[model samples]
Target chain A: MAEKKMGLHTIKLKNPPSILSTATIVGPKEGEGPLKDYFDIVLEDDLFGEKSWEKAESKMLREAVRLAMNKINLSPDQVDYFFAGDLLNQIISSSFAARELGIPFFGLYGACSTLTEAMSLAAMMVDGGFADITIAATSSHFSSAERQFRFPLEHGNQRPPTSQWTVTGAGAVVLGREGKGPYVTYITTGRVVDFGIKDANNMGAAMAPAAADTILRHLKDTGFTAADYDLIMTGDLAKIGREIAADIIKQNGYDITTKFTDAGIEIFDLTTQDVHSGGSGCGCSASVFGGYIYKQLINGNLNRIMIISTGALLSPTSTQQGESIPGIAHAITIERSLEK
Target chain B: MEKRKENEIKNIYQQMVQKKVPQSSLIKDAIFAFVVGGLICDVGQFFMNLFLSFGISKDDVGYYVATVMVFLGAFLTGLGVYDNIGKYAGAGSIVPITGFANSIVSPAMEYKREGYIFGVGSKMFVIAGPILVYGISSSIIVGIIYYLVKVLAR
Candidate 1:
């Protein structure tokens, strides 16, 4: 019989797909941040020699995909599938990058949760014997996101303290069916949760509950406690959301304060960076996982980790039309082999 | 039954979300707006004095000073400096004639990619359109009332 489905949303892969190589490229602000050394490329100029911020983002994603492929010594043509997404309208950055790559592409949109969503799908394809190797990638640019979601950079609009800076970067990971590396074991998909939050500036508050809900459901479905993993990372929830998520999770009978860390808070030093809340965006988690988390896993510094990336799914039109922001979180568990 | 269940879930979610929303300080925001707005007006006043010293008639000084200020605003917006000022100063940067200049130039620049006529020209008034409509309409109405009162008095 087929492998047992533990819970409604959880997927347990029988032959877990291994992450072969990963790459990250970040803009100057992100490069200056605490995780600067972890990134593969820290661009001096955000434009990256491109005419527009949108083009620059596409270039960053393409370069990340190339860099990841180079690390694995495999060409783009060898990869079976390419999954990518970004925060831009129609996800132009990913689609444009895919045009240059000339691969079988599946464009995804999960806002900041794109990384975990892409990773989960890529792992499923590899584990189900549908593909040998696949690549999951996502990107975001500060200027591009500002113009699309908030105000034009030229507006000089004041940002509230709760507002998080969109990290300007791209991250890519190559997953293979057979590899001696960190294995993706399980994935838990989250439902859309809207708590009547209408302020687009305060995304942390909007997405925190979804993060908590997913983490709780994943633990129950997989029969794993918070203590089971060395680290439990949430994508781009920043400081405020992280605290709220912790509170909700604690009330649900799981306390992950000691094990929990957020990509938004980890990417930037809140005290010094002037990023009022923390780093955020599709790139926030993507770059963090590719640059820092993956390195720790490969180096054996961390044995098991659960990444729960959260997203605030609000469009410019929706926000303007007085619609509350809906949030979603997707979780993936990756583990290192004991024998290795 | 399904509709009721959905409403129940939404209510629970709303309560949870309400508890987490960050408190925004009105006093702090107002102070930022006041200071920034005041500073912009000061710059306009400085320009007015400079124009007056140029020996232009006092009657013409108002027009010249306003023209200079508007030009400066547009120029700075093009250079991408005005936006930075707007960010920190918030409403302060926006309350002045300079902010009006920024509002026009910003959308024009953004839509420049779509071509001059369709993109830049069409979108130029996106932010300022409503303000212009009301401003001109109100002045016309006031003018009509003054004219009617004068005719009736005579």
Candidate 2:
């Protein structure tokens, strides 16, 4: 007997329109009243100060998770599992944050790509029936990251043109059974690629090749072309990185033209701002995905989208050892709704 | 529940503000390092913006910025400022372009006593070489496509 062909069992979002509740906590904008109704918690602390950044970052993550759970009408106990990570030493911020959330947690690290990685995993878990609800989150504070990874914010250091402004914020998103919102339909994971560039300051160029590599894989795996989605976005590959990614894609015989954009470059109005290329940090993608794109989804301006979060896997020790900067990118296909 | 975390933070803050390590006070050192490091980046940005105003294309900005940063980083390393910054700010001094330069050169300089070819010369470009290679290659490939588009569009 021929087996009946069932419709695609990919994690499909149920409602055609998905509402996003977002919270942004930047050092400059801390202490402000509620960013929005759905967003309830906002913590004010600088990670780079002589104070304890990990502690503050942990609290921020907890706050973001708490708000996300409340906004989604889910209890912390009800969130079957927590998938989270951050740009902290040993991902301690994520681990600690998850501890407070009190959910079964799986800690992940993809540098700035942590949010998308969380989303991809959470979607699969929900789709596989391992969990009915999950939360994906990430946080990065410029001061804290700088002190731990670079120079202190008060230091009179110079940044390279390829540098990105690591953002100071944490964002969370809750995923559930395809009821109402964007569904993670497919994912393409990329192998790390290093073209021997070791300048951590110039991360965009270091990470672009990986972005190009994964986007190509994504199109191939899903049998979808650039036209399949209205927008194709890459995470944290700022201005220079985006240009490099575009060039690589063009060389590979696919031209994204003006339609393709990178979140790092798009997040800020560069002309009016000194954030040379654009924003970086785990929050760079997390906030853009949760705050900006999620809104567009609810507005029905976007139906299908492919988001590839690119990460530069460089550490202080590796940079010191003269090792090349290797990059990894993860892509997730999102549809407007899961239900037919 | 939140009060415990807040109290913990207060204790850490008090310790950081009051205590001095062997070389200097932790808070003083950290603050000094951060200020100096930030000023360096501010100056770099100023000049970079200046070059852009002088009509330098964005394509060449990275190399120029890198060169200037290398000089400053090497100078800081020589003055022992970077080391002090490291003691205080920890990762702060190491995360910027200058820090990257220090990472590349300090090792190469240490290895110079061993030999030039395997040590200084070869190791000098350890951190930035592959990125340049890939970047240049990708740019050239893209440039060729742009040329083709220009001709084909006509």
Candidate 3:
């Protein structure tokens, strides 16, 4: 009744929330990647002097959140809500980081799709007149994810070709009621889609269907073709998933092949990086969008972008129990505010 | 009727995924495994010869050779060299006694953060524990069969 809903699954905000500031931090491996200069902080070591990988991941999330707020001279008390998530069990990284910030927290677990989950929800809160300023943050450390999801650090096991390297990083975005430019205009909440994919190594394959479903629905709702947006970025779809998603989207009558780009494929050089397929995890999309794409928007290098972050919701126990992975994707349209 | 259509789509999607995924060559992997695994065994044989030459009894040489190989595996794992070797060698590295050593030592090194007692001591056998349990139990069964056969012969 308040705002005109675009169709099923699409939210058209009456008042758009502005992206006030963004900060990104990554480990040495990601810093060595192509988007090295974009990140605010490049950790020389993965551990960052923590005794355990979990602690290190928590520290990175905290630092990125603080840096985002500090850039605009806003304190933790100023931010009305905190939306944070990570790949760790119980999302310990976000929970621990949230403890230190003393902000009201909404702990999320959308797997690799946490960034958009945080962003879209934060935008909703800001547009609804509930809060003035909000922060959306997520983190994923390679070692932490490995121990929690795969194997111990020293465990000698070969990664399958389908496997992706989790980006060791964290990203934070501070959103406000009014700002200069780069406003969160629309959110397309994803529905859970499962092709009953069982192989966790092929996460890109598992999530590709959801990525296609969300993008197709968003386009159908908004009545906009793929040509309308400058870029349509999917989070951590990597090589195989990106291809499969593109194929599926085209089959559904919306051809986004030209405009489509995946944060997973963009974050690392596939041939040389030894990241078999490409970079993945929540931080893959988070670090890419929060650091690189945000800068491009500010510089007017890009006009409009639809970021559809995908998640393959499979826990270690579920995978062991032969439960199929259910994939989800959430999308947000961030546009450059029209200049006067 | 709706469920059947969903099943059809899922089947089509699965096939597409299989095509897109890069296939690993089994023959190529096997070659690497044969070479690297053979080298590890050669080193074990060398140790056996070395221990025998050192005036250690033939009976004691097997024990000494095993200790040396296990020590080497643990040392390389600690230095973070074995993981790299294991990557290329695949089962070549994993099929040997050194692999057994790696199975035990790797988890111990990783879990050291949780502390020596609960972390290292308990998790040390996590990978190799099932093997030891089954291996010993099977041997007891085999030993009892031999005892019965000897008694029957008498």
Candidate 4:
């Protein structure tokens, strides 16, 4: 007989407010809809130049961290540790910012699922007695990323409708000792899953199956149905990936029709931004979660939310190998506790 | 006197290095670098789009884009754009074909003096040859698979 490998853990957020504030950073303007109050930070001020690339990223990251700290009224020194990273090289933008903040920091890189990875790690630290308060953050800049990942702005490459836009911004969150709000109760890390896809433009299609695998595993491990939580969130698996994830979940007979949502999908609803399915990058969730969702949490608009941040674990070497994309996802549960 | 002379020389070298690249605020410098780099690309893209709108065919877009990209890549590689973008975007530049173009041409250009046959010719295909092979092979395989699927469905 095969023993069950899935494990489950739970935590209750104290003084769980109904609504949490959420913020979104985009090219030059602040984002609207379900995000205004959740976060008050904007990248428009620091965003400059024909493409400030590294300068833009480092600036946005600092602003995002500053915003999250401000919203929660916590200083950098008071925070136990700063957890952050990005899709950039050596995750320098994150490390560099953390250095300046002078907070004890732990850097991480999870491609797109960075927000969830940071959240899960911060949750563990808070729950494990390692620290009482920790901040999780992530960022990606479009100009900087495009020049780095694809063509320079001058290359004039056209994007297909299936392609997802990487947003330019950063997001941060301060997770304190359980009594302040809903704390992360459980987390499930996903293995790298691939479907032999090589089209770099269509990431959602490549990442959907990975999302499904993890969601199913999370439900199995927790012995809970989709209806157990108010929302089920996937990080950055844009439109195509969301459809694939939904199909996979439905195929498994654990339907999440009413509740399933994606950070990448929702954030890109503003067409003026030209992002087909919304924004991607670790900052998609970090800023949205810290800015928009946190506001709703504090306002008592939403009580329990399960955030499943998703990541794609593809490197330049692997992509160049003609190998398919291997995606990884992580799920962290946040909800209100009775005692607080 | 000998030790003092060596020390003075070292001090002059340090001063020269500092003058070449001043140490500013890390966060400010990084942010400035990222934003400026991004804007330059934006301008380049705008011009590319304008050029494409002038009736330059799609397939040839690569040719046009390549000229600009090669120049930019060369400059960046020269001014250290590749390394900076690498720090910021990770696999950002290299993931694109332009990156492939840079990877092939830059090293070849640098080592052309080593003999065109051993250096330029050999190294030219080092980064991109396999991609072309895979691209062609996959198309064939995919075509076969499609045919099978269509026949089976019928």
| Candidate topping DockQ | 3
Candidate 2 chain A: worst-modelled 10 consecutive residues by lDDT: A1-10
Q: Over 4 Å off in model 1, which ranges?
A: A1-4, A338-340, B1-25, B53-59, B140-154
Query: Candidate 4: which stretches are off by over 4 Å?
Result: A1-26, A29-38, A45-51, A270-272, B1-154
Q: Indicate whether candidate 2 or candidate 3 has the larger DockQ.
A: 3
Q: What would the per-residue lDDT of candidate 3 be over residues A258-306, giving only the tens digit for each residue?
A: 9999999988889989999898888989999999999999999889999
Candidate 1 C-alpha lDDT tens digits along B1-154:
9978877877886676566666667787778879878887888889888887888888888888788878988999999999888877778888688888888889888777668999788988888888899989999999999999999999
**Which tens-of-lDDT digit does each residue in B56-123 have in candidate 2?**
99999878878888898878776657655654455467667787677665656544544788867875
- True lDDT of residue B113, candidate 1: 66
For candidate 4, the lDDT comes to: 0.67
Predictions ranked by TM-score, top down? 3, 1, 4, 2
| Candidate closer to the true structure by lDDT (higher is better), 1 or 3 | 3
lDDT per residue (tens digit) for residues A90-110 in model 2: 998889888777899999999
Model 4, A165-210: lDDT tens digits are 7776687766776455555666777777766556676677667777
- Give the lDDT ranking, best first: 3, 1, 2, 4
TM-score of each: 0.93, 0.64, 0.96, 0.65
**Where is model 3 more than 4 Å wrong at Cα?**
A338-340, B141-154
lDDT, residue A8, model 2: 31
Candidate 1 local accuracy as lDDT?
0.90
Q: Model 4, range B62-118, lDDT digits (tens) per residue?
A: 578767866766666655456456444434455554456556655555445457898
Q: Write the per-residue lDDT of candidate 3 for residues B1-154, one digit (tens) a residue.
A: 9999998989998999999999877888889889999999999999888888889999888899989999999999999988888888899998798888998999898888889999899988988898899999999999999999999999
